[model samples]
Target chain A: MHIATRMKTRTQGGITEVLVLVNHPMDTGLVKSPITHKIIPAHFIKTLTIAINHKPAVITDMGIAVSKDPLIAVKLKGAKSGDLVSVDWIDNEGMTGHAETHVS
Target chain B: MNLPRRTFLKQAFSGTALAVAAGAGLLRPTQALARTWPTWPAQSFHIKHWRDLEHSLFGSKPVVSGGVHLHAPLEAENGAVVPMVISTKLAAPKRLALAVDHNPYALATLVNLTPHALGFFNVRIKMGKTSRVRAYVETADRVHTVDRLVKVTIGGCGG
Candidate 1:
């Protein structure tokens, strides 16, 4: 599966707002396929990492309850223009995706 | 010359072995020590009720307070995509977590933030039905909680 990630950052008054959207199915394994009537194996992002200027800022450990195509936002203090904000996530199936953007 | 080449090969092999070990979940020194990633609470998330989730995560009942703000719609048109935002003016919160009272799994997401980061976050969650969603903000001394009741028009969990 080709997982896609997009990140956006905006800095104002020393606080940078970071928004990230990751493309993932986030199946809970409890749901069954409509046509096949088979249980869909659980596939979701277990861990998500956010970094500012290559330094770890926030680490989110998620469960199956999180929505599909997860959209996460966090605010960073003391961030400035041109600071790099990056996001990475690993799913239950060992798949990973990464995206980075600079604060504007 | 031969001795130096052999030493270089040995060092390179050991480095590769270390990388493999880390990938296999054997050694995670940096992650454990530097807070690069917090361990997922699989057992806590498996709890199905509000009390059980609270006991597992906080070791006691957290105090319900207005210090934490939970922003969510009174009625979610789609249970599959319920937007939730949590923010607090509390100082240097160590952790933030969410739980859905009526879902099969109570615990939704837990975030570990560094001291420098703000105590605010926004995310989307799924609701099996109309349920109460709770957010917990843990500081050094206390665990503050806030909950909101949301009516879901359609169930999110498909069978």
Candidate 2:
């Protein structure tokens, strides 16, 4: 599945909120492959990590039960709007994708 | 002619009994409801469509609150790709999930957020037709749901 991400930042109560959007198929082992006429094996991003300035901000572990092209939002401390936040994710099939956003 | 009278009486009696049996509760209803409701056999898109309103996800319950917001196009030109967004106003959220009804399998995606992250997300989804998009949120030791409808003009999922 093709993946892409975008992030937005806002401040509340002295904390920065980081929002993210990711593009992916996240096939849940139910869709059939047209050529094979067989169920496409479950392959999806199982883990997602958000780091602010290379520090661990958030980590998420997912399963096949999730929807396609999942979107995630998070809140972090010590980061302000207009700061750089990095995101990295790994799927069950061992494929990895990364993205970055300026906190705003 | 004498032999025919007994046969006719017996036939009449049996017919009356059969009619009575048919009218009583012993017979099943003539019009049975179809069982087309969604079902999840193996937690996939083809078996059951995800519904946040129904609270059918694993390890989560459905709640309604102002913190959860879901956005999608009122009408989609292509079911193959529909844009969607889910945002929350909660202070600290633990988990977020999205489900689509009308696809072969309903549970479309799940997003787990970090402890120190804002509650906002955006993504693209595949739709089969006009379906309900549900957002599931876990916070304050409970689960909540917010839903919106999306209409698809073109068939997706290889339909």
Candidate 3:
């Protein structure tokens, strides 16, 4: 789970918006190795869960259709600067990544 | 820190088991929100053709309409990340989904908009080749669609 994620949270008019960007190859398993010319096995993030103050808000199950290093943006009820927002994801390979932040 | 090698293997194995359960249609999400916001069937993600995807998502079939607008490039330099935006004149769109005709799996992102959020969504997605990118939008009662063709000079499916 060597995922590097960046999150920015902003609140306006009782609405909190969180933007999350993840770093992953998102390998589709459709491309071939230039040298070996073999179809790489399909491996991509299968599920992503987002929580506001530890309450699940957004849950996404993605496949190879997602681009490499996917972007996920979520909107929820407004939270104070110290409120917690977290994102957790598990890929098709079963590797998982988690990150959390307090609103700025 | 990354997980230990043994733990990684264990997680991977369990993931495979979960996938198998999903494949058997036993891996349904228990949350109420997911139930309200529609999601594609687990296997439908691998559909190779756009028409099949339409049938799966739209129930009957999606009609070509001008109610929605797709903002995407006529040509993309990097197939790995082709930027796109979607908007609709239709009143209060509830969900938006993207599908690539030429990609190995046609269905891409399926976005469910919160009631408070406006019906505008922007995303950067992968293109396997030069293909038609279709956007499907669901409103209160019906679904509307529009598509744009983009040329990918460089392939992005992992080669």
TM-score result, candidate 2: 0.59
- Cα lDDT computed for each candidate against the true fold: 0.86, 0.65, 0.74
Chain B TM, every candidate: 0.75, 0.63, 0.71
Highest DockQ: give the candidate number: 1
Interface RMSD of each: 3.3, 13.4, 4.2
Per-residue accuracy of model 2 over B1-159 as CA lDDT, tens digit each: 465988999989999999997776233221110111112223433336354324454445446655688888989888766777777877678777777776655665555566656676665667777988787777866776778888888866642
Q: A1-104 in candidate 2: lDDT tens per residue?
A: 45676666677777876666667677767578889999988777666677777554666555454446666656577677667787777676766666776766
All candidates in order of lDDT, best leading? 1, 3, 2
- Model 1, residue B156: displacement in angstroms? 0.8
Deviation of model 3 at A40, angstroms: 2.4
lDDT of 3 at A101: 86
List, in order, the clash count of every candidate structure.
Answer: 0, 26, 0
The C-alpha stretches of model 3 lying farther than 4 A from their native spots are: A12-16, A74-82, B1-40, B61-67, B88-92, B114-118
Clashing pairs in 1: none
Query: Could you tell which candidate, 2 or 3, scores higher by lDDT?
Result: 3
Using lDDT as the measure, name the better of candidate 1 and candidate 3.
1
Q: What's the ranking of the predictions by TM-score, best on top?
A: 1, 3, 2
Instruction: In model 3, state the lDDT of residue B145.
Output: 90
Which candidate do you rate higher for TM-score, 1 or 3?
Answer: 1
